[model samples]
Target chain A: MLQEHAKLITFFSECKELVGRKRLQKMIYILKKCQFPFSERYQFHFYGPYSEELTLRVQELINLGFLQEEKEKKSGYYQYRYTLTGEGEKFLDHYNLDMPNMDEHIEKMSETSSRFLELVSTMLFFEGMPKEEVEEKVLTVKKKQNYTSEELQQAWNFIGDMGIQH
Target chain B: MSYQSEQLREEKVFKDPVHRYVHVRDRVIWDLIGTPEFQRLRRIKQLGTSFYTFHGAEHSRFNHSLGVYEIVRRILENFKEHPDWNEDERLLCLTAGLLHDLGHGPYSHSFEKVFNLDHEDYTREIILGDTSVNRILKRVDPKFPQNVADVIGKTYSNKLVVSIISSQIDADRMDYLQRDAYFTGVSYGHFDMERILRVMRPMDEQVVIKATGMHAVEDYIMSRYQMYWQVYFHPVTRSSEVILTKILHRAKHLYEQNYKFKLAPLHFESFFKEAPTLEDYLKLDESIVMYYFQIWKDEDDEILSDLCNRFVNRHLFKYIEFNPNHQFEQWMELHKLFTEAGINPDYYLEVDSSSDLPYDFYRPGEDEERLPIHLVMKNDELRELSRESDIVEAISGKKRTDHKLYFPSDFIEALSDDSHIKKRILEILEG
Candidate 1:
């Protein structure tokens, strides 16, 4: 169970890096199309929440080692360029996922979490499961059996306090 | 469909000075905030009679509730991005934040003093019992409401989620400190919240600060220390609280004595009867209390009228620094002199002390469950914050206590011009 959960964690971490780097790559593409230093003439606009979200992703990528930024000496505005390291390209190739787009991944994840909780609750209720049985089943369903003693204890403590009585 | 996608028809924004704007994206959070029960928080003062001293502290629990919700929103946003974070805890955290202070009644400090009520227990009841908040949370799932209540009760096993809302330095404290400082206009409460948030890391059992951010944590602790001394324990605020407490005591005493009040205590009936329901609490706010206080200023009962006049008209009792250990005899002597001067010592003379022992280094046998702040090092090893941080160590485990003797200076001045009693009182006050 622990190994499976670790694999899940690895997947999530990699996916996050992929999405972030991909977003950065797209911003670089847009920047390159506009010029070395971005100009208003590039038809690039950040007008809405989606644009704001992409800007946050770009900032994260810059914070990580994936992208490089330079401030224009005259304009005093930041110009971002992708400096794809060996690791970055390898990550991109492993996923076979294209550069980021401001699509619905976050919204999808939220829906997935809500659905996961609902499904678990429904199944437990349907089975007339006892409290421990329900928790055990939920843990198994999530394939989190390989958690550290402290992690398992913490999860159990949370489960007990969450009042997930069947 | 998931509740997150079910946006409000028209986006509702709570104009919170602390959070700037508490944006309601979900219909559930929006509906819950609009409910009459929740709206009543607008009428209830957050700091109770503390406004008498800190005039700028007129903000209500409604403001605080919104601020708490906003902080939780940001924390959950961070958690949602983390791999260890379970996204399922999002709604629970939000619900707990919104409804945490729902059970607070008007003049909460005084009401609790006289009525023996626990607001935390009431918070749970309001969430899990029959209420608008409960109904909205339940709509998400049958157990969703209970999950919220459990979080507020600190019984939820998810330490990370629970700590975000209820721990020593969680969303509740973060909101109240920043919100209280913003309203009271006190510099002492200012801390780099952005820095604190950046340093926050979720561990298995609780949230810990990264070692690099220890200074920020120390700054937060110092801010809390200053707030407690400057705002929370202001002598003028305590004086008003003392007067407010005496007013209730006097009224309750009169009611028990079968004293015929000119205006019947209709609003205080349930309170006098000792069992107030949700409706009773909902009707009791600072406005309603002030309305009754305005009316009570005309009552024939001298004690009641005078107390009401003192509270409403800003005629608070004056106080002097007092040492409980050394000034015990002096305080007792003043109590007798006060009675001789025809002033009730019980109502007029009060010894109020406020103390705070800031963050402590974890000592196992010396202090049980101290929950010392942990800082995760670059090596992924957890270190007790005070061990490596000099600023935190400087003030850790050091307790500071302040005592003050409060009394009516006006009465002393108005006493007979030739009275030596006034001289004695003045001498003690001067000392």
Candidate 2:
């Protein structure tokens, strides 16, 4: 497999199941910031650090039948979900690739609400800003500017406890 | 122990002059530093020949590397609570930051130019091949070494991870600016890095600054421009660099011509052959290279001996601003005059052109160069920094190039054969 594909497959295997596009992007972004060796360009997009490279990588995996993207109606909106195919399972077993602590991470990531994920991701986006500026902007950057300084502090604590804070 | 067992029982700190203190928490990082290969960096001067111009620039790459790692460490600590921060790959970021410059040989500018070697290639080899660094990394995981190499190589699959080390406003730049300024004792390269860091935000797959921190970012951009022109591209340092290059060239030429030297540059044999293995390259550093230059001062070849003496004793060439295109014929005439005065024009004359695009913020077609610095505006939108800042916008995409003509001033002054050519050459050069 191409090294890029190996990375994608490995990411998927570590995730343990298919995930939503937003969650996957956040996961990949977290991995990259934490220093996983991936080469994709990202920009501040609708959800947060969006990448055209990742969009294409996901498409390529689906086209090759290594992954399946399914849509489900939830609250009158269609939500996209991703999962590995049977062939993807075989290919993964064949390579027997390993990524340390990815399984536990995927489990924790899966349990996170998208809104809370957005909060943490957006708060992080203000890396070197002063506590006040991060607090003020973190609240407004979201669709609803209702987040509190307490929540922001909690988000930081959560990141450290997870052992991922650089 | 398994791969994760590389974590240290306790953190170790290096008291740094630039960053104050550099902390290493992981055993992998500590082991990598302790490796002989990494220690070799201590013997290689960070600024190379710049020390000849700025006496204070005697720091080594090892010092700069630690500074880079410390900057990354702070940035990482700031990142810990970001919802998108991945806890597992924490060590990878630290490792890449620490070992980024591992492959650099002695007097890298001359070594790379004369021998066609890139320190990056050696960085990869050291991180992935049968080296102590690779062993320490592999003990973390077999793929860990390659993964770390890929980050330094700028081919890693994760864009944000790559940016931490290689981006326009990443850890590498943040550290080098302050560290270099501190060592060079120059006022340039000073920016509110703490402010810059404070305003940094992890935007999904890229890092950005808050709009409130725009001024600090602008100061950084301006500082970079000033440092490039003031310190990095200083003519005196370039003159020392030119002399250093000429010394290497003369040695290679004499060796190729079968002139038996009083001291053969055995360490530089592979380099003289223009093909250096990783081991051969690793064995070289500024001290070893300077030792050879010192001994070559009394060599059999007159040109080599003279050039070596000039470089070893800091007798650098003198230079004047000259456009090669405009002064082509005058330059050629001067070269001819030098040859008549019994100086080898090839070894004595050179033109050095240095340029920098102070900042390049997404010029439509050049989006991939670096993800331009972004500022998270209060309106819940992101704007490219140059788009919002007039100072950055003015200099963005504009490359300022400066050219200078260099020659042996002492040779012209020490002219033996009472020739008018020396006077004519000086007139043309001074004119």
Per-candidate alpha-carbon RMSD to the true structure: 22.5, 17.9
Chain B vs. true chain B: TM-score per candidate: 0.94, 0.95
Prediction 2 TM-score vs. true: 0.71
Task: Name the regions of candidate 1 deviating beyond 4 angstroms.
Answer: A1-166, B2-5, B9-11, B355-366
TM-score of every model? 0.70, 0.71
iRMSD, all candidates: 24.6, 18.0
User: How much lDDT does each candidate structure score?
Assistant: 0.64, 0.74
Q: lDDT by residue for model 1 over A78-142, one digit each (tens)?
A: 23223444443443344343333322332332232222323332233223446556455444333
**What shift in Å separates residue B136 of candidate 1 from its native position after superposition?**
1.4
Question: Pairs clashing in candidate 1?
Answer: A1-A146, A2-A146, A22-A100, A157-B157, A158-B157, A158-B158, A161-B155, A161-B156, A161-B157
The CAPRI classification for model 2 reads as incorrect
The per-residue C-alpha lDDT of model 1 at residue A48 equals 6
Q: Pick by lDDT: which candidate is best?
A: 2
